[model samples]
Target: MIFVETQYDQTPAALNDLVENAALAALKHQSAPENATVTIVLTDDEQMHSLNLDYLGVDAPTDVLSFPSEEIDPETGDPYLGDILISVPRAANQAESTGHDVESEAQLLTVHGILHLMGHDHAEPEEKERMWQAQAEILTKLGLGNIQVRES
Candidate 1:
């Protein structure tokens, strides 16, 4: 099981659990190395905006950002994926915009974040297709059909 830490005070209890479940499910579906570890830090949009500007050269806050630490470990066979940081307030706004519950939207973003940790990206057409399909399957299996994953 993966451990998730949140810096936001308003983050709901169920939100963390949903994120964990999504991470576990994504790891299993991706066939990642056993016991692969990563950390997730949830914060408000203001913090996320600063992080985005500092790390990604963007001025706006994003839903999630993934920083891959050890894609391939030489010492250990287990591949340490990466760290995922999500904005709780942004997620809440997205949930409202996408017509889904807060928990479901957060879980979707969590799944998307875990996919990035596994080296899945959506910058190109083929890559986006594969990543989105994987996310859709994982979300569907996790009972997230009502929540849509738009190709943005």
Candidate 2:
């Protein structure tokens, strides 16, 4: 299951169908066990800037942040993947810069965050290759409303 909480003025603050589709795509792409859950939060740059500084030691606003909770929920036994927080304004700018729609950019971030939750990292060359391959595959499966994965 995917739950999204947004605190921004972006109309249609959240897109339920795309979120569900991409999340399910992530789970299926990873062969994740059943009963997995993830939460996505959409806020502004200030919130993300503070979070980035506090956790990553980077005093800058990033497009997205993924916090993976690799433990099972006590009561439900659900594999809680993590939280994906996005800066809506940042995403909008990124989308415009990248020649894509805001929704597409946000979904890409969702795919990236879901990949992180599934233990895919891009800190090293080999890891990056695998992560990009996985992202491409997931996004391809997602077909993301015609937005393709950008080379990273």
What are the per-model C-alpha RMSD values against the true structure?
Answer: 2.0, 2.0
- Per-residue error for 96 in candidate 2, Å, reads 0.5
- Candidate 1 achieves a global lDDT of 0.86
- 1-152: candidate 1 lDDT, tens digit per residue: 47799899999888888898889999899988777987888888888889899998999988898888776557766666788888998888888988888899888888999988888899999999999999999999899976788853
Distance from true location, Cα of 1 in model 2, Å: 1.3
Which candidate has the highest lDDT of all?
A: 1
**lDDT tens digits by residue: candidate 2, 1-152:** 88877777663544546666777788888998878888888789999999999999998999889998988899988888889888888878988987888877887888888888888888988998898888878777766545655542
* Residue 11 lDDT in candidate 2: 30
- Candidate 1 TM-score to native: 0.92
Q: Which residue runs of candidate 2 sit more than 4 Å off their true CA positions? A: 11-14, 145-152
